[model samples]
Target: MPAPSFMGIYPPDSVQEVHQSLPLDPLGPGAADLLAGDVEYRLHYLLQEAKKFMVHGKRTTLMPEDIEHAMEALNIEPVIVPPRPLPQAPFLAVPIPSGTSGAQQQLYTVVDDEIDFATYLKEPLPPALANSAGVKWKAHWLAVEGVQPAIPENPAPSSRAGPSRLPAPTTGAASLRPSAKQHLTTELQLYFSRLTAALIPTLAQLPNLPGNSAPGAPQYSFPDAERHRLAALASVRSDAAVAGVLAYLVRWVAESINKTLMGATGTIGCLIDVVEAILDNDVLFVEPYLHQFLGPLLSILLTVPLGPHPTPSGMSPSPFELRTRAADVLAKLVNLYANGYPGLVPRLLSTLKKALTASPFPSPLGAEHPPAGRYEGAVLGIGACGVHAVREAVWGTNGDGLGAINDLIGLLYPGEGRKNKAPLVRATMKALLLLTVPKPEGVTAPAPDAAAVAEAFGPHFVRAFEKRPWQAQELMRLRNGGGAAEAEVDAAGEEDDEMEEVQA
Candidate 1:
C-alpha cells in the first residue's frame, strides 16, 4: 500500500529525532514522515477533546486531569503528566532557529539560585494579629405579622424601599418585639425570623372600617394552618440550641395575649398556636423562661369578653374555641414540667378554683374570681388536669366540687343562683364526667344505679348526665372501677358529637 498522504506530509526531521532512542535502521521510503504524521494526529486529537471538557466545565484554562480524561474517552492508554507550573518570572519569547523574521513562541522561565533551609528559618514571623472575635449573630423581626417596628436591625421607617401597604399596630403594641439586648449567629437569626413570621398574626386592625361599619376587620392575611404546621415541625427539629431566643418568643406570646384580650380581634388563635408549638417542641429550653408563658396563658384561659365574638357572617373565631385550646396547652405545660416545678400545678388549681366559683356579690375576694363568662374556661382548665385531679381534687362526699358541678347545672333549675348558659352547663358536665375516666388505681366495684348518682352529685348533675348517656355510663364506671359498661361502647359510640368533639 502507498504511504498515506497526510502522514507523508509530516516533518521527517522531527520523526528522525524521535527515532534516535529506538533500536531501528534509517526510515525506508516515506516511513519517517508517516510515523511523524501519526504522532501529530494523536496529539491534535487529544488536545481538541481536552478543550471540549474545559469549555464544558466553564473554565478558560485546561487542567492535566482534563487531558487524562480525554485520553480515556478517545480509547487511548492513560498518561500521567504533572501539571506545568506557573513561571517564577515572566517568559522570554525566542525565534524558531535562534534568529528569524517571524516569531515561533518558545517559553523560558526565570529561576533563582537555591537557598538553604537554615537561612529561611532566620527570618521573622508575621506580627501576630490581635485575636479576632469568633462569629456572632442576633435576630429580630424586620416585619412581624406584617407590622414592621422601628428597631436597630430594620432600616428607619422613612427609609423603607417603597410605601408599605401594611397598617400600624392599632394599640401601638409591639407583639413580636425583640429584646433590648440580643446575641445571635446568622443561622439563629434566620430561624427566628422564619418561625415568628410563620406562627404570629398581625396584632392590630383598624378600630372600624372606613365607609363600612364592620368592626375589627383585619388588615392583613396570616399564614394558613398548613404553614404553621411546617413551622412547628422545624422548631421541634431545629431548636435544640435556641435558648438564647426563648426570651423573645416568650415576650411575644405575652404581648400577643395582652393585646388580644384588650379587644384586638382575630389574633388569639394564632397566639395559641405559637404557645402550643413552643411548649411541645422537645428541644426548646422552656423551663427557664416558662414563667413568662404562664401569665399569658392564664390570661387567655380566665379572661372574660374576649373579642371579636363570632361575627354574624361567621368570619371571626369564637372566644370559646380559643379558651379551650389555651386550657389544653396549659395542661400539657403543667403535666410536662410538674415534676421539676412542684408548685406549678397547685398555682393553676388555685386560679382555676377561683374562676370556677366566682361570686355575684361585690366582695373584694369575689372581684378576684373571673366573671361568669369565664366560668366555662375555668371548668375546662380543671378538667384538663386529668381524671385523677377530678376524682381527688374535685370529687368528695361532703358536697365538694360535686356541689359546684350541681349548682353549675343551672339550665333546668328554678333557683335564683341558676345559670341558663348551655356552654357552661356542658363544660361542667364534661368536668364531672372526668370522674369515670378509668384509672390504673380504680376500685373494683359495681356500676352505680341512677339513684346512687343523683344522691352523690345532685339532681341537677344526674339530670345533665342522663341527657349524655355516655357521660352517665362513665359515672357508672367511676362507681365501678373499670366498669364493664365502657367495654359495651362500640366505634359508633366513640364518634363524639360536635360539643363533645370540642370538649375532648
Candidate 2:
C-alpha cells in the first residue's frame, strides 16, 4: 500500500485519520491547502476532458471513469476516486448530518421516483407543468421515447461564419437509448416528475393566505406541481452532466416572467441571474439541453405566485440565498453593459422600472420580513444599477444619463406616499447625488438647469442636491454659461485656421 505522503507538521495520529478517511486525500499537510483545492483541481481536469469529449459526442457526462482516465494520463493516481452508489432509486433520501452534537439530520427525500415513461408519452403532462417546466419533459421524454427531429438535407448554421454543423432535431419515443444521453433524459424526467408531484400542495395553499388582500396577490397563482418541477430542474442544472441546460432554464424563467406572467420583474431578475451565472463564468459551459429545459420552465415562472407584498413575517424564507442570486444576476447584466452590450441598456432599465413599480417600497410594516427584504433589495439594486452605471455605459455623459437617474428619483419620491417612500427616496436621492458629481467624459457638459434637476427629483430633490456643494456650483456654472467647455475647442480651432491662412 502506498503510505499517503503527509506533508505537514501534524501529529502522526491526524495524518492516519485523514488517510483513513480519504486515501486519495490529495490535500494532506502540504499536498494542497484544503479539500476544496483538491476538488477544484479535479474539476478543472474533468472540465478539460469533458470539453474534448463534447467535441466528439456533442455532450457527455464526466463520470468517475472519465476522471480516472484523466488522472492516469496525468500520472497522478492520488486523485482517482472509487465510485460510490449513484443516486438512482426513487423515494430515497440523502441525509446530511447536522453540526450540533445531537441535531437531527437534514433529509432530501425523493417521494416518487418511479414513473411509467410509456404512459407519460401517451398522455400529455399536466398543462401547468407542461407550460412551465414543460420543455424539459417534452425534449427528454422524446429522447427517452427514441424520437428524432427531421434532419434537413442542406442544413446551415444560424450565422454564416458560425459552426456549420447542425444538431439532430430530437423527436419521438424511439430516441431513448442505453447510452449516456438517454440516461440523462430518463433521470431528468424522473426527477421532474417527483418534484412536480411534491410541489402541488405548497403552491395551492399560498394564495388563500389572509393577508393577500391586495389585488395583485390573488392574481398571483401557480400550480403547486410547477414548483417541484423547477426544483427538479435546478437539480439537473447543478449536475455536471448537463451544465449547459442551466442557462436555458434561466432564460426560460426570465421570458416566462415577462411574457406569461406579465412583468413579474422581481422573479424575472432572479432567473436572469441564473442565466448570467452560466454565460458570464469562464469555468463552465452552457449545454444544448438548456434550450429544451428552459422553454417550458419559462412557462412556469410566468405562472408561479409572486406579488408586491412582502411574505408574511416569520415565514422563514431564505433571504440570503435570494439576495445572492439577485446580486449575481444583476452583476452579470451590469457586466454585459460595461463590456459593451449597449443595445441591452434600454431593456435593462425597462426591466428595472417594472420591478420597482410593482412593489411597495420601504415596505408597509413587515418590510424586514424575509420575503420583503429580498424583494426590496433586489429592486433597489436594479434601480441603483440603472441610475448609477447602466446609463453611463449607454449614453456616456451626465446629460444623457440624467434621464435614467431622474426616472429612479421619480419612483423614489411619489406624491402623498412621500412618507412611505421616505427610505427608498433618500437612498435613491443619495445615489443620484453621487451620480451628479460631474466626471465629464468626452462630451461637453449641458448647461445645468437647477429647475429641471429639482423638478426631476421632486420637492425633496433639492435637499439631496444641497448636500453636494461643489456639484451644485458646477451645475450653476453650466447653467450660467451658455457654451459648455465644448466651445473652447472650437475657438482654438478657429485661431489655428487663421494662422494657417495668414502663413499661406
Candidate 3:
C-alpha cells in the first residue's frame, strides 16, 4: 500500500508556486530536519555551494551565505557565544526586559540572549521588584492579542510574573528540570558506553597472553563475582594471566546495564545508587580494577546518543574533556587493532562520529581553543578521526558507510579555517586512517543503517580532504621513512646498552 498521506501535510498552491520559481533541490528540504544544532553549520557550508544552482526568486541548493544568514537568525554565533545564565524556571515563565511602565506607554522587552550579568545589573530595577538568592525578579505586562490589562491591586507574589518568589532548594534531583535530568543521565550513560566498547576486544585477547598461568593467579570465569578479584590479583602481580580483559569485560557489563536502565526511572535511580555505593566503598580499591574499563567505556560513550540541551550551570562537559577522552580511546583502539584487528576500525569510527555530532555542546569564547582541563583532546581527536574516517569508510564500504562518514564530516568540519576548527582534529585524522583500511577477516562490514553518514558527508568530499591535506601527506612521509627499520635499530641499541651496563 502507498504510504498514508494527509492532505493537510501538502504545501498550499501558493507555496508550490513559489517553489517552482526557486531553484531548489528536491531532496535538500526533506533532509533538512537532520540539520539540527551544530549540524546547521555544516548545512550552511553546503548551502553556499548549492546556491549557484538556484535562479533568482527560485530555491536552489542551500549556500554558505544562506546558511550563515540562517545561523544568525537562529542565534548560532559564529564567534563562540560567551557563557550566559540559564533562564531558571520561574524566570522563564515571564516576559523578559520588564518593559517601561511610566508615561510613554511604549512597550519595551527584554531578550534573555541580550541580557548578560553586567548589563542586567546596570539596568534600573523596574517598579515592584523582588530579589532573592541573588536573582532579581520582576514582570512586564505587555499587550496580548491587542488587549492590555492593568496589574491587579495588591496581588499575591505568585500572581506577579517573573522569577517565582518561592525559596530555591539546595539539593536533591528534584531541583533539576525533567529535560535536564534526562540529558545529564544520557551524557553519563554515553560516557560509560564508549569506555565499555573500547575495552572489549583487547580484554578478549587477555586470557590468551603468554605467561598468563602464573602462580597464585586464579582463572577467570565467564560469570562469577570472584572474576574481578582474580583479575585484580593478576594486575597486582603484573601477571599476563588475566590480561586487562576481565577488568574490561566487567566494565562492559556494568555500562551495558547502565544503558539498559537509563530510561527506567526506578532502575536508573537504583543504578545511580549502586554507583554511589561503589563510590562510597572505602574498602575496595575500585580504581585499579575500574581504570581498565575506561577504554570500552569511552568507546561506548562516544557512540551513545546525546541531547542538545544545556545543563543548569550554563556549562556542558568541557570540550577539553571531550577531546582528551576521545583521543585516548581512539589512540588505544587503533593501537590494539593496527595489525591485529582492523575490523575493529569501523566500529571505532562509528563511535567517534556519534560522540562529536549527536549532541550539540556549549560553544563559549574559550571553547575555540583547547579546553583547560582533562579531556581537552576529545573534540580535536574525535574531529580528526571523523574527517578521515568518513572519507575512508565511505570508500572502504564501496561507497556504503559513506552516510555515516559523511554525517561525521559535517560534524567535524562545520566551517572554514583553523580558528573555528573543532578541538579533536588529531583524533579525527587517526580515525580516518583506520576507517579507510579494509577490515580483516572475522570483522564485519560497517553498519548498514548508517546511510545518514553518506548523505551528510557526500557533498563535502573535496572540502574534507582540503581541510587537512598536510596531515595525510605527513602520514605517508612517516610510513616511507624506513619506519620499522628505525624502530628495530632503536630497540637493539637500547638492549645493548642495558646489557653493557649490567656487565660493567
Best model number under TM-score: 1
lDDT of candidate 3 over 100-205, digit per residue (tens) = 7644433444545545866776776532232213445555565557666555634554566432221111112322333333445554344333323222213223
- Which of 1 and 3 is the better model by TM-score? 1
lDDT of each: 0.60, 0.42, 0.39
What RMSD value applies to candidate 3? 27.9
TM-score: the better of candidates 1 and 2? 1
Worst 10 residues of 2 by lDDT: 163-172
Q: Highest lDDT, which number?
A: 1
Candidate 2 residue-wise lDDT, 340-407, digit = tens: 54544455455444554454345334333212332234334554354444223322253443444345
Q: TM-scores for all candidates? A: 0.48, 0.31, 0.25
Q: Residues 317-362, candidate 1, lDDT per residue (tens digit)?
A: 5566777788788888877888698887778778877766665333
Task: For model 3, give the 10-residue run with minimal summed lDDT.
Answer: 163-172
**What is the number of residue pairs that collide in model 1?**
3
Better of 2 and 3 by TM-score: 2
Ranking by lDDT: 1, 2, 3
Each model's Cα RMSD: 25.2, 27.8, 27.9
